[model samples]
Target chain A: MDYTDYYKLTCSEIQKLYRENKASPEQVVDSYLKRIEAVDGKLNAFVKLNRESIDKQLKDLKEKKEKPLYGIPVVIKDNICVRDEETTCASAILKGFKPPYDAAVIERLREAGAILLGKANMDEFAFGSSCETSCYGPTKNPWDLDRIPGGSSGGSAAAVSADEACLGLGSDTGGSIRQPAALCGVVGLKPTYGRVSRYGLIAFASSLDQIGPITKDVRDAALLLNVIGGHDPRDSTSVNAPKPDYTKSLINDIKGLKVAVPKEYFVGGIDKEVSLYIGEAIKTLGSLGAKIGEVSLPHTDYAVSAYYIIAPAEASSNLARFDGVQYGLRSKAAKDSLLEMYNRTRAEGFGSEAKRRVILGTYVLSSGYYDAYYLKALKVRTKIKEDLEAVFKEYDCIVTPTSPTPAFKIGEKKEDPLSMYLSDIFTIPVNLAGIPAISVPCGFTKNGLPVGLQILGKPFDEETLFKAAYAYEQNTEWHKRRPSL
Target chain B: MVSKDNNNKKSEIDVGYVAKLARLALTADEIKRLGKQLNDILGYIGKLNNVDTAKVQPTSHVLPLKNVERTDKVVPSLRIEETLKNAPLKENSFFKVPKVIE
Candidate 1:
């Protein structure tokens, strides 16, 4: 096979080539490096490329036991640490801070002999939904360069969609993984909150953050998840539940499965075309012998509100470790006092959105106002979780649009923080409820931009989502469509 | 604390004070811009006030498990060189920081 064609293959497909003796691991890695060089300048998907590290990985693979992701190239979000490599969550404050240890997923990937592709850019500290807040600059959508690939996992989604890598690792705090997958025409899954370890994922809203797979299709998503999902004693929050072989759940049968369409997700602000596609998707599911009905999650309207408070509060606390003492950038003006050093280092290092969120988080958690804001948001979070629990008790899964709109212009919502916040509305509730959700391409708008259909399931029940998503995906051509790049 | 504006809406939040608490120093221009932005966002967040969560227990974590314990055994830790590899300013084996004492 030609080296140019290597970038188009999925994880399993690449493994097949190896079995056929048509391609070697080094050849595959070289193909991706060449492809990235040819296109990454335009997409800016990568913050840093592990050009030298690949040779070492390839050399190490020669001695490791064959595993699921062997020789498969995977794009990792910049926030996930890779030993001796810079893991700066696209924040200027963390510039030049290389971790001494690999991420949990990275360790798993290495154990499986997968190539460490490169670090994808992200919204600085995962604050923005547009990915424009990245200090390394925004990653362009593969579908349309002028538009944003939905973020804060924008780069991860775009990298996978463009076939820059077979799969990408993205952490979803709100809609980071799925929204970008929706906009970029890929499949992204945010596994049940504790299904995958967050041991090495740079914290952003810890209660909501979960690392998962972004891939070209549902099967690949499952294939990658099988390698990464499991209990890790390192991450106490990671569930100790039995790990299922996710690929076994990719049956093309959702017959008699109960799916609920949350009425609130479609009522207001959703793009007409996006809804039209999702409507067609619902009909497709019904035609596939699945039972479908409308259900109301009354707390849906307040998801974004509660999220802004809760996520920022967690972020403010998680990000406090970035002071100049340990690593990253230290303010040059930090000469007189420790407080002054901290103030100036953060002031100079943090971007506008980061500063806004830190302030907002501080305001909510501050004395005399904690009850009115922070505690209130936590209570609201309980209500949101209950809403999902109630629906899941009667329904097998819930379906909705991954995002309210398709890819919007890059600069369109960057200035308006509220508008930017609303982009993740449909995806935020899943995080608040701590459930699993997958975004698969349902169809594209008339403008050629892809719209995603989000399938959410009960906590620790990603298998059902894969089953349902696979059934729908097998019957649609949406996931097969690639950008003309 | 929120202060009522002329319209009787809680609109004024001291953005500068909030930034100080956050350990972020902002310029006057940033304070004004981010201040209005914060108020607009806070007004949006105010929607949560309508939910009757008075009787509801806050679900801080999604998992039901607690005290996720592991064996309290000592293991190899990062070497001093590796630990201090990222320090922007460092002494022999320690991170050098600004003097906290006056």
Candidate 2:
């Protein structure tokens, strides 16, 4: 088979090939490595390529053929640790840090025989909306080299979109997975909070972070999710709920599905073209016999505000572990004083966005101001969750544009922090509500950039999300389109 | 509606004091740049004050789980050498920090 054909095969397709003995895992890995070498210089998607480790894993996998993800090469976000590999979260602080243990998802993928392709780049510590904030430099959107693939999961999405890997695992704090998937023209799912374990994921915001799949298509997303989703005793926040066979939910029928389009999401500030695409997508779903109507999420406007407060406050606490004393970069200038060492190491270690968030987080959670900022944000968060819960009682799913606009130019929003935060406006509320959501390519703009139509379902009801998303995907050709890079 | 005075006062965040609390040493330039950026973000988030959250409870975790605990039992931990492997400075199997007292 041609190398391009090999690289283009989905996870299940590759698994079928492996089962038939028509393709060896070594051949698949070789094709991907060659593709990454030829394309990554222009895409900058991967931070560290696992050529030697993949070879070793391929040799071991030749002996076992029963696993579901056998011989499928998968890219992982930098934040998800793959034991003994450099697991830097694209930050200078963790430049050479190699985790001694694998993340729970990585462990599951290995047990299922998925070969680790490499670690993809991300915004430093998952702090930015674009992958441009990485210490290693920006990951350009494969669709257009001058634009950004929405981030902090940009590399993972871009890799899947560009066929650099069959699938990718990325952590979503606030639209980190879904937004990037939208821009990169791939399918990305942020599973319900706690539906997937967070054992070894480098924490961004403890309550909001969930590692999920970015895949070439919806079926692959479900297939990957089947392997990675379940309860783990190690992650206390992990829900002790029954895991469903996600692939069974990938039926193409949404005959009686109820999908709501929140009026607030379509209000001012949305790009006209994006709104048009999403409107057409709603019509398409309606044409497919799904009940679609406009619903009101009264507190939708406050979601971004509440997320900024809550996520950063949690981040300030979670990131306190990186003090240069253990497991990361330490400053040489503070040899004489521990206080200086702590301050200098952090100041020099973190990037601008990380620093901005840390400072904002500290201020919000500080004495006297806690009740006003941090506590108030939490109250608003509860209100936002309540708003969604009330809507869910009457609607099975909510549909909206994944991003207000398509992928922006690389440096467009980098200097403007507020504008950068707005990129996640449509996707942030799902995280705040702790529900499952998927971003599937719905259409493209006149500039040839892709737009994603987001499908959000109730907490732990990813099956419903998959059903609805799969229905829309099967009826459209958007998911089949690939960038020319 | 919430009073504008409260929102205005809240937006006047002290970047220097916040940086001190965060244990981050910033240059004068960064402080100036970050101050403007933080104020801009705070101004946007200030819209939350418009909502009447007087009776709302703050949600720390979305799930209802609380006090998750495991049985109190001893378990093997990272070996001493392994634990000390990533430490930037160490002495006699212990992480070494700068001297704190004379």
Model 1 has a clash total of 0
TM-scores for the candidates: 0.98, 0.98
Poorest lDDT segment (10 consecutive residues) of candidate 1 chain B: B1-10
Interface RMSD of each: 2.2, 1.9
- Per prediction, the TM-score for chain B is 0.88, 0.87
RMSD versus native structure for model 1 = 1.6
Q: Which candidate's lDDT is highest?
A: 2
Tens-place lDDT digits, model 1, residues A1-485: 68767988888788888888788888888888888888889899999999878888888888653678878999999999999898999999999989999889899988988899899989998888878999999999988899998899999998899888988999999989999999999999999988999988899888999999999999999999998999898898988899999889988988899999999998878899999999999999999999998998999999999999999999999889988889999999978899999999999899999998888888888887788888888899999898899999899999999998999998998889998999899999999989999999999888899999999999889999999999999999998899988
Worst 10 residues of 1 chain A by lDDT: A61-70
Candidate 2 lDDT over A316-425, as tens digits, reads 99889999887798999998988888999999999999999999899888887788888898999899999999989999999999999999999999999999999899
* Residue A34 in candidate 1, Cα distance off native in Å: 1.4
lDDT of 2: 0.91
Best by DockQ: 2
